[model samples]
Target: MKAAVIGLGVEGKKALNSLLKYGWEVYATDLNVNINLDNLPISLSSVDISPQNDKISFVKDNLSIDLGFNNQEKIDSCDAVVLSPSIWGSKIAEHYKNSGKLLCDVKTKHRDIFTIGVTGTNGKTTTVSMIKEILENAGKNVLVGGNAGGGFEGYYDLILEADKQDYDFLLVEVCDMTVGFCNHCFDFDLIALTNMGNDHMDVHGSMEGYKNSLKEFFADKIIFINNNQEYKEEFRELSRLAIEYSKTDYDLDLFGKFNKLNAGLSEAITNFISENTFEIDEKIIKNTLKNFKPVEGRLEVLKLNDCEIYIGKSDNSDAIKAILEEVDFAAVFIGTPRHNENHRLDILNEVVNANPEAIILFPGLEDTLDQAKFRLHALDYQGRIEIANNLDEIIGFVAEFSHNPSILIGGNGQENIIKIQDRLKEICDSFNHKENRLLFED
Candidate 1:
């Protein structure tokens, strides 16, 4: 058997590795040919493509490797084509489909795997991570990946690696975009929805469309859903084993009522798995819940001098509202990559209504701080509004002006977030190491 793996982003690389491990002659392609393989996620780095030798080749930036086969010819010669979620609707995918080649996505290839797929607009990474942790505490050999770091780079990679390993269970973070592309391919043994909200409409087109994509993928699966989510009733007809979960009080290291609810969902899923698959001691599960730490970049708190800074990557109105509801902020610094502007404006309006001491907006690639400033002004907000030149300027301003300030840094740019996080941690560490102020003598 032969396979063609398209798009060498995280997921595509995983597919390439999986195909090779399964002993299929593989060919790969990426629009970006100049990627340094060493800099990729840890999972991709371990993929051994060396064994396939001359049978395996890559097309980079429209140029074929010296392997003596053109890109299109290699793709056409493959028995099956595996597409990453990013390239689901691309012209290349369309071409392969038209050629009558068997086209499948990362999820579909592992349809028979005993999988727990989690999907929602928010809290997906946290919830999935919790599930993985709880199951591991129960002494189950588990593989957790998809959209976040735990096992591999992407779902494709995770599934591929899981196939080779002796994992007792698989936990996957399923994105709505992935559902939109490979809904037909999903065969989850158990599924979960954290909470559905208005998000990714730019890709899904409309609110109804986004909901339907989830509805279709989750239909006929053993499902768990949030009882408090909007449109909860709509999901009732989608599955026969649909179970609804509500908020539960648990002594947890994480903050926010939403996180408490996430813990509840994780507990419920763990219980369900224990009941259906294997025996899990309730004591161990409880201990794990009590000790579970907050997922990184989701309301991560850093104390500097007299200020308390909360940094997260929350880019939607609902998530922002949840953060503002939980913390009494003196100031907020927000930066987001270009996304649905009108939706962001609505979220910003809610931020204004929260009425912090100051609002700092930073420019993303597509949207400017000036645009956000205008929106806040139009909302009749009378509080201080400032435009941040950079993440450092925002951090410096917050440290200088406000006492006990709550600095919120969020956006869609993961690279920028990592940089900001590193700088923030460095500043906090430096402050911690400084000598205490002398009360009376110097």
Candidate 2:
């Protein structure tokens, strides 16, 4: 038997690795008619085993990937064409499959290797990382990799590596895009939704559209969601295992009420697997929470001088809103307003309301929030509503307000976070606040 994998992105390499291990001759290709092998994720071993080298070919060169898949010659030689999720129902995908190339998807592993997908607007990566770390610490032999794209391969590799003695579990942080869901539909055994929020509308368009994308992918398995009005009303009778988690149920260590719910969902899933008696160690679960560090760019507290916080989250509006709730800031500086201006404004309004004394600063955000200050007008924001276009200016401003009880750096890119932290160290050294005060020292 032969397998053909297309689109040499993160998932492509994973599919290739799996097909090769199954002892099937595999051939792969991508839209990169011009991209070198180095640029593609495939290894030399996968290419050599390709049916293409054996006079039969696996991949067809569909010049443009976004539109129709036009190349049919490449699809004619394969016994089966493993469609990468990125390839939609374009003319090429339709034509290639019309030739009766057996159709299979990543979801085929439901038989022996049951799987779960973690999806949400934020914290999905960290939550997935925590789960993987916990599983590994318990020596459960697991694989964790997904949209964070941090080098973790897919189940195809894990299935081959199982060897009846090695790895057994898989944790994937699936993306919130249609392409992400289509791929997940065929790749895994079970699915988990970390939580849903108003995000990715630029790509998914409407809230209903994004939620439908979530529902379509995992319509068969369990979906773990929050006990919110929207989710409850929309998925009223969705058939699959519907689970809800909250602090009223568990004392999850993850920060925030939302994060506590993340813990709840993780616990629910862990408990389900535990019922099957998977031999997961209690120590592993504890270690996963205690040792796992939040990703660098996501709510990572940079400095904690005088209860002040400099935080970072991947330049998404939803993340900023989450961070605002997690900590108190006397002033808020956002590095970039990359998405959802209205959402970012909501975050600013909430932060200002939550911390009455907080001064709001939009250093590099420009006129995105021309909506102006809601509570404290710009003139009213003396040390607070300050704007600096350059890192030097922002750092100097941070030093100026180093006296404030607290300051927050919102957005993942705190271009001024590190520099300001270093400056604080100098001031602390000169003033000798070590004896009088400190960030967490008190």
Candidate 3:
């Protein structure tokens, strides 16, 4: 009956509340020593406000939010430990397991609802969002979550909210790391693989390891996979019913061949779900595809007078290649961090091959710009390459000098990319109103 929630980040907070609702004695810990409660999400604020609330009193009285420095004692005393997916495979988790304690991850339980899990190196968020949209358009009560921003932040929150609501389908974005930790714990009716490519090598340690992690997720489930993926055959063998999807050539609102693949995967999953459950009209699928907007930070476009800006969160080489193949950019502002050394080389090579007019590297990357610069030089790259100290410099350069029809701003981290998107939107708004014509002209 007693549970200890580790890592009081977004997922941890949701786990704490869910455990409380399930009538478990919940204790919580956060490794962030400086988390401000006032800045916490409204979800947490709603739960913390009631002093007369039994859950609030139980947590406050028994748990200490002490940066997880003294959490081992609390964890040892608990019957079960619920871990945030971020802490999966960590030393702390291994130590707890060695001590003979029951450990569960965020993906545990929620078997009552019909779940559709989408996993791959790319297109997970978009594909899952599309499935949610298509199902909802068909009048199915659906809750979409896992890895997308705004409202549906994490799977833990989604599962908790779905439990209270009347949702016929729960669309989840399942990451490889999550699958690696708790593959056996997931009870999904169906699953989808967007596409697999070289990504997250730092975590998985090798290409083989990353692929194996994904393979573990599809076992015994009816899986929908992209037919064009290199590892499709491998994935097909593992699933109970493996459905392969190819590019549909639909004039989708989203750009890129990969996105087309995403749409194809989405449609396949929707059709499978609909055929088994209810009749989803073909018009609903077509309309949803035609009108579905691109996921934020994934090839989102903004057009100016002489140039267009494409912002996305593509951190890996394959994702970057997909974007480059779709749009010819005069310049590229890359914010992806250098995690996997081999993948970094591949990304640099792709950037060189694309041969943009300029390449502006931003902060938030693990590898230094100097190193990337050296690699570019080695590749005989002729384009302009500079490392901006901040996002402002990159924006200023693009606003002033970029004359090509399109420019790209994205990679790896969402933090910097989101900031660029907001700032660019503000600037674009001013230009649209003719209030900042002088800025662009200069």
For each candidate, what is the lDDT? Answer: 0.70, 0.55, 0.71
TM-score of each: 0.80, 0.65, 0.81
List clashing residue pairs in candidate 2.
26-50, 69-92, 106-186, 106-187, 107-186, 107-187, 304-439, 313-412
Tens digit per residue, CA lDDT, model 3, 1-442: 6788777766677666666665667766675555445423234433433333222222254333444244567677878776677786789867765665543333234556788888888888888888888988888888777653322456555655654566787777877667754453446898887777777677788878877777777777798876666677888887788888887656898777788888988888778767887889988988999899977666688866678888878777888888888788888877646544545556777878999888888764464666667778999989888888786787888786546788888666676677788888888887776846766787
**Residue 160, candidate 2: C-alpha displacement in angstroms:** 9.6
Off by over 4 Å in 3: 1-3, 7-26, 29-63, 68-73, 76-80, 86-109, 148-152, 338-345, 365-371, 378-380, 435-442
Find the 10 residues in a row with the least total lDDT in model 1. 61-70
Candidate order, TM-score descending: 3, 1, 2
Model 1: residues with Cα > 4 Å off, grouped in runs: 1-3, 7-71, 86-109, 148-152, 180-182, 339-342, 363-367, 433-442
Cα deviation at 18, candidate 1, in Å, is 8.2
- Rank by lDDT, descending? 3, 1, 2
Which is the winner by TM-score between candidate 1 and candidate 2? 1
Candidate 2 C-alpha error for residue 137, in Å: 2.5
The candidate, 1 or 3, that scores higher on lDDT is 3
Put down candidate 2 lDDT per residue, 195-310, tens digits, no spaces. Answer: 66665566667878877776566565666666762655455466367766543244443456656656656666676676664766665565456555655444544333454555
- Candidate 2 segments whose C-alpha is farther than 4 A from its true place: 1-112, 148-166, 179-187, 233-236, 248-254, 281-287, 302-304, 314-318, 337-395, 412-442
